[model samples]
Target: MAIAVAATRQVLADSYKTLSGASTVWVSLHTGDPGSTGTAEASGGSYARVQGTWTSGSGGSLSMAELTFNAPSGSFSYAGLWSAATDGTFYDKCALAPSITLGSAGTIKVTPSFSVS
Candidate 1:
């Protein structure tokens, strides 16, 4: 199974929950039509609600990379969720509405089983 933990408002701590095998799941947003483009959508199009959980992995936590996908290469607005529990998902500890601007570079380090990748 997948897991999530909250750190802050604009960051999300996700865990692939990988034990012996790597987990793979699709991410969806609740805005645009997730059509024609399969799971991922084209630019500007609204996305479906962000769904699915990544199993807790080595880097069990990750601050949803802000603006990592922003630029001429992958320009788009994205929403994120934050949780507090190492495997919290039942409720949202915090919510990241939507961000599309160029974000400042920073880092968040998770210990024991997680870190910035």
Candidate 2:
């Protein structure tokens, strides 16, 4: 089988200002049951991180650079904390590293840089 490097577009809200190249950081989403209670993707859960870059400005597209899956043992810390909601704190559904460093690109679509496992 062949592995493909791809990702979907992640848009930025007006409040976020905009998405830039290497400016934003996000994690990958895995396929499987979230498991039992407290088995969320970033909360005491397992996930992977895919590094990439955005070519354009704050509203263009994302170009992946690399990917890594580093699952923590217990507890979890998302990129940013939600103002009102705690569950929506994480930026990426699947995560390992701290965050992706968006480049000069402001905002654009995003995708995986390589084959993520």
Candidate 3:
């Protein structure tokens, strides 16, 4: 499937003002493609938030963040950013490279970057 590369209009607006300062940000893994809607939540099969360090990116070039799933479960082809740590609005979507498969061991890292030009 083709990758859906779009951030929410609200996210784009808030991102410039106070999105970076939002508390309890989270990144979730998704097997379902973002499609045209470009929004989704992790409340179904094999979907869960990765437990890792979420380093918010700095600078006016790009508002980005990195997530390293210490013990990511299942498999996913896409990733998303949420405002709340759990059960929040999906602000952005990203299709992973080569997909991510979590087995018995190892870690999964996903770096989602945002830029406006």
Candidate 4:
């Protein structure tokens, strides 16, 4: 038998709210799972992590403001959240439903969201 631990709605909401309070969240592009250390992070051709602004947590979830990376060249399949622009901390990551492939002159836009259930 599995022991099921359930959290109340308020607890879920609060958890997300706390996450939204991170000081400087950075959004990183990846070719695959970022792993524990944010491996496979995209680089070169103007590719750089962008600072992310998050909406206040609500109803157990929070959303990142849309982020745009200009002139980034890569084939990205995932996005990772970090504490700084470079090497602060790896919080989490998620897969991009369709993935993004950019050439040297184009841009990539993403709006990521988080939730606690």
lDDT per residue for candidate 2 within 1-117, as digits (tens), equals 322322212232222322322344444332232333223443223344333333332332333444344444433322221211223333333342544332322221234422121
* RMSD score of candidate 4 (Å): 3.5
lDDT (C-alpha) at residue 73 in model 1: 27
> RMSD of each candidate?
12.6, 12.8, 7.3, 3.5
TM-score for each of the candidates = 0.22, 0.28, 0.55, 0.79
Which prediction has more favorable lDDT, 2 or 4?
4
- Writing each residue's lDDT as its tens digit, candidate 4 over 38-60 gives 99988777778898776645445
lDDT (Cα atoms) of all candidates against the true structure: 0.28, 0.32, 0.54, 0.74
What's the ranking of the predictions by TM-score, best on top?
4, 3, 2, 1
Once all C-alphas are superposed, what RMSD does model 3 give against the true structure?
7.3
| Candidate 4 residue-wise lDDT at 50 | 94
**CA shift at 60, candidate 1, in angstroms?**
9.0
Candidate 2's error at 94, in angstroms? 9.6
Score residue 27 of candidate 3 by CA lDDT.
72
Q: Could you tell me the TM-score of candidate 3?
A: 0.55
Worst 10 residues of 3 by lDDT: 52-61
- What candidate 1 gets wrong by more than 4 Å, as runs, is 1-16, 23-67, 73-75, 79-96, 101-117
Compare candidates 1 and 3 on lDDT and give the better one: 3
Candidate 1 structure quality by residue, lDDT tens digits, 1-117: 333433431133343333213332223221233233332332342222332345343333532322222123232332222232122232211212342332332221111222432
**Could you tell me which residue pairs clash in candidate 3?**
none
lDDT, residue 51, candidate 3: 33
